[model samples]
Target: MNYVLYAVPFFFLLIGLELLADRWRKVSTYRLADAINSLSAGVLSTTVGLLTKVVGLLTYTFAWQHWGVFELSAQNLWVWLFAFVFYDFCYYWNHRLGHERNVLWAAHSVHHQSEEYNLSTALRQTSTGWIFGWVFYLPMALVGVPPLVFLTVAALNLLYQFWVHTRHIPKLGWFEWVFISPSNHRVHHAQNAVYMDRNYGGVFIVWDRLFGTFQEELDEEPVVFGVTTPLASWNPLWANLQFYVVLWRDAVLAESWWDKLRIWFMRTGWRPADVAAKYPQSKADLSQFVKFHVPLRPAQQLYAGLQFVLYVAAGSFLLATGANQSVAVLLGSCAWMAFGLYVLGLWLENRPQALGLEVLRLLLNAPALWLAEQAGLLPISTLGWSLLGLYSLASALALVLVARRGSAALPA
Candidate 1:
C-alpha cells in the first residue's frame, strides 16, 4: 500500500517539531549542510531502491512459491502478529551483520556518517544494502509468510525505528526493558568503546538482550555519535562509496590473492598487514573529535536550501508516478535527479566551479523537460515551459550575484 509514501509529510512535520524543540532548549542538534546531506543520501537511496527492489522481491516470491511449509494467509490475525515479530528477528541479524562485516559495513556506513543525532539522521540510509539484505529474510519466505504480509510488517518495523534517532528523548523506565527505546538506539549509533557493536534490534529489544549484544546507555560515559572513521565530506554520493573505495584500494595493494579476496568479508576494520604498514589510516581520537563542516555564506546557504526544496518536489513527483513511466522516462528522471544532487554537494562544499556546474545543469534542464513532455512522460503547457525557463534564468542570475559579492564564510 506504499505506507512509506503516505508517511512522507509526517516525516518532515516531525523534523520540523524536532527543530522547534532544539530552538526551545537552545541545543543545536542539526547543522544545515549535515542535515541536507543526510536527506540527500536518503533521497538517493529511495531513487536507487526503485530500480533494485525487484531483486529482493523476486527472490522472496520464488522462495515462497516453491518451498512453503504452510499456506500462510495475510487475512489471519496470528499471521500478522507472528510476521511482525519474525521480521524484526530477521532485521536484528541483518543490522548486526551490517556492523560486523567489512563489505556489509561499506553499504550500511552511510547512516552512521552523520555526526548529529536528530530525526533527519533516521532518514539517512544506504543505496547498496539490497546487495545482501535479502538473504536475511529467506526464513520468512520459507515458513510460508505471504509477500504482502512480509512487506507490511517490514515497513512497520522501519516506521517504528524513525522516532528513535533523537537526542531529546530520555530513557523510559520499564519501556526500555522490552521495546527498542530512544536511549538504547542512541547507544547503537555511538562509536564509543563501550557502545560499539551493541543493541542491534529493530522494534524489540528482546533480540539483543537474548543474543547478548545489549549494552545499557550509561550516564558516566556520555554517548558520542558518528563512526570512528569520519566521512569528512557533505557529498551524499561520496558517503555511500567512501568505505568501498577504501576497501578496493586495500584489496589492490594486498600482495596475496587470498588477502585481496578475503579482505572484503573480514571483520569490519581488518586490514592487510602489508597494506596497513605502507598506508596508515588514522582513527579519530574521541576525546578531541570534531564534526566535519564547510563554511558557506548566508546567501549560498539560502540558495542551496531553495534548490534542495526544488529537488524534493521533483523527487516526490518521480516517486508518485515513476512506476508507471516508460523505462526511458524513469532512467532520464533518475539521472537528472542524481545530477542535481551531485551539483548541490559541490555547491555546499563552496567549490569555485559549482556555479559553472549548476549553470550547465540549468541549461540541460530545459531540453530534458521538453523531451519528457514530447515523449508524453510529462504534460507541460506553454505557460508551464515558460515558468520553468524563467526559473532557470532567475536562478542563473542569482548565482551570478552571489558569486560577485565574494562569498562570506561563517563558522558552521
Candidate 2:
C-alpha cells in the first residue's frame, strides 16, 4: 500500500489548520516562497524516490529471504508490535548518523535548509538518503521481519512525525518525556549549539533519552531554526546538492589523497587543513542571523502560486501511477518536473532572468504535453491540447505583466 500517497490530502488539511492557528495567535510561521521551496523539495524527493526506493526494498527483501536468522511471520500480532518499536530504533541511528557524518549530512541537510518551523516543513525531506540509510535497518531484516511489515511500520513512523513540525503546539508536559512531541521535535530542528544534533528519535523520544542525545526545549534559549550555514537560495535542486558540492570541492582541493578520500566519512564539518586555510567558510553568528528572503511583488507571488498549483496537481498524478511506469517514461516526467521547479525557484528568488526562464517554460508546455501524450503518460484529448495551448499563451502574457509591474516597483 502506498501509505504516503494516501496521506497527502490530510497533510495539506493540517497545514491549513496550522495557518489558521498562526492567524489566531498573530504569528507569522510561514513565508510563501519558503513554504513553496520546502514543498518543492518534498515533491522532488517523492518523485526521485519512485526511482530510488527499490535499492533499499530489494536489499531488505533479499536479506530477509536468504539469510534471516528467524522466520518472523507478518500475520503475528506481536511481530507487528515488535517491528513498530524496532523500526524507530533503527531510524534513531539512521537519523543520528545523518547529522554526524559528512557524506550523510550532504543528503540529509535539505530538511534543515528551511528557516521556518511549520507543517509544510514536515514534508521537506532528503532525496539521496536511500544511498546509505538502508543499511541501518539491516538488523530488522536479519531478525526476519517480513518486507511488508517493515514497509508498513516505516510508513507509520514517518506519518506519526508529520504533526511534530509545527510551532503552534506547546510542550505537553509528560508527553515530551515519552513520545516525540512538537516541542522536543522543534529542538531537533534547532541549530543552536545546545540543540544541535540532538533528539534523533522518530516516533518515540525514549531512544533519544536512553542514548543521551535528548535536549529539552528551553525557554531561556529560544530555538533558532535552520542550519548554521544557511541555504540562501529558494532552489530545491540547490538545496539538495549544496552540501554535497561543498564536500566535493573540499575533497578536490585537499593536498593529500588520504584527506581527499577520508573527508567524506569524517565528522560532519571536518575539512582538510590545506583546503580550510585557503578557503575558509564561517558559520553564521546566531545573534546576527537573518532569514533568507527575496520579496516577490503581489503579482509575482500570484503567478508563482498559480503555477505551483498546476505542478502539484501533475505531481500527484505521477505519484499515484509512478510504480507502474516504465523507467524511460518516469525519467522523462521527472526531468520536466525538475525543470519546472528550477524555473519556479528563479521566480521566487526574483532573479532578473526569471521572466525569460518562465517564458521558456511556458513555451515548452506544448511540446511537453505532446511528448507526454505520445508516451501515454498523459491521455490528453484534442480539447485538452487546446486548453494547454490556451494556458501557455495566457501564462506568457501574465509573466510579461508581472515583469512590468516588478520593474515599475523598482527604483530608477
Question: Which candidate wins on TM-score?
Answer: 2
- Deviation in Å, model 2, residue 149 alpha carbon: 0.8
| Clash count per candidate | 0, 0
TM-score of 1: 0.97
What C-alpha lDDT values do all the predictions have? 0.91, 0.92
Q: lDDT for model 2, on a 0 to 1 scale?
A: 0.92
Poorest 10 consecutive residues of model 1 by lDDT?
403-412
Top candidate, metric lDDT: 2
Show where candidate 2 strays beyond 4 Å. none
In candidate 2, where is summed lDDT lowest over 10 consecutive residues?
Answer: 399-408
- Candidate 2's TM-score reads 0.98
For model 1, give the RMSD to the true fold.
Answer: 2.1
lDDT of 1 by residue, 18-136 (tens): 99999999999999899999999888888777777889999999999999899999889999999999999999999999999999999999999898999999999998999999999
Considering only N, C-alpha and C atoms within 3 Å, which residue pairs clash in candidate 2? none
